[model samples]
Target: MKKTESISFQDFMNESYKKVKRRSRPYRTFSFVPFSPFAMLDPTILTIGGIVLGVVLIERFLERLGVLDIVDKISSVMRFLFPLTFFGAIIYFLVTF
Candidate 1:
């Protein structure tokens, strides 16, 4: 008498495992930190760098909106409210967390 071929649990799992791997092979490194203090410098340097970056970003945004020349006027007004914004953020974080 001839013996019939049998499918074991291990064989079934191996085939399914290969299909899962193939399907998920496209997504590799998901979490990424492009900018971090550890990669760059001390607090003082970071603070100054952040200020410069902020100025550049604001300038770019204003230029895009054709308001680049109004930055100085905007800054004078925004300087006062900057503290309020910080205080509000702190209060929000404390209340939520």
Candidate 2:
């Protein structure tokens, strides 16, 4: 086995300070989201976010166009489902495990 050089405590600390990460672009941050990739990323979360985004965009567009008063019906359904979704997901996880 090859012998490795041991770093002094002071040398290790100095080396850590010297190493800098250069950012190629500005960081994107979202509220209530963590800076970690693994913490922020989950396939289920991504799918849910995408679905919500599309729904909101479509609703807004339809509202602006004054296509119909369909949003009221959707809002009613949302009010009922919102709470159920939160509680149901927790129950689903519990049952799955």
Highest TM-score: give the candidate number: 2
Cα deviation at 39, candidate 2, in Å, is: 3.1
Off by over 4 Å in 1: 1-56, 60-69
Candidate 2 lDDT over residue span 5-84, tens digit each: 77679978779645679879988877774245564355665566677667768777887888667877766776787677
Candidates in order, TM-scores: namely: 0.33, 0.45
> Which of the numbered candidates is closest to the native, going by highest lDDT?
2
| lDDT (Cα, tens digit) per residue for candidate 1, span 30-93 | 5465444454354544565576568658866886888856876767766785666657654654
How high is the lDDT of residue 81 in model 2?
Answer: 72
Alpha-carbon local distance difference test for all models: 0.62, 0.66
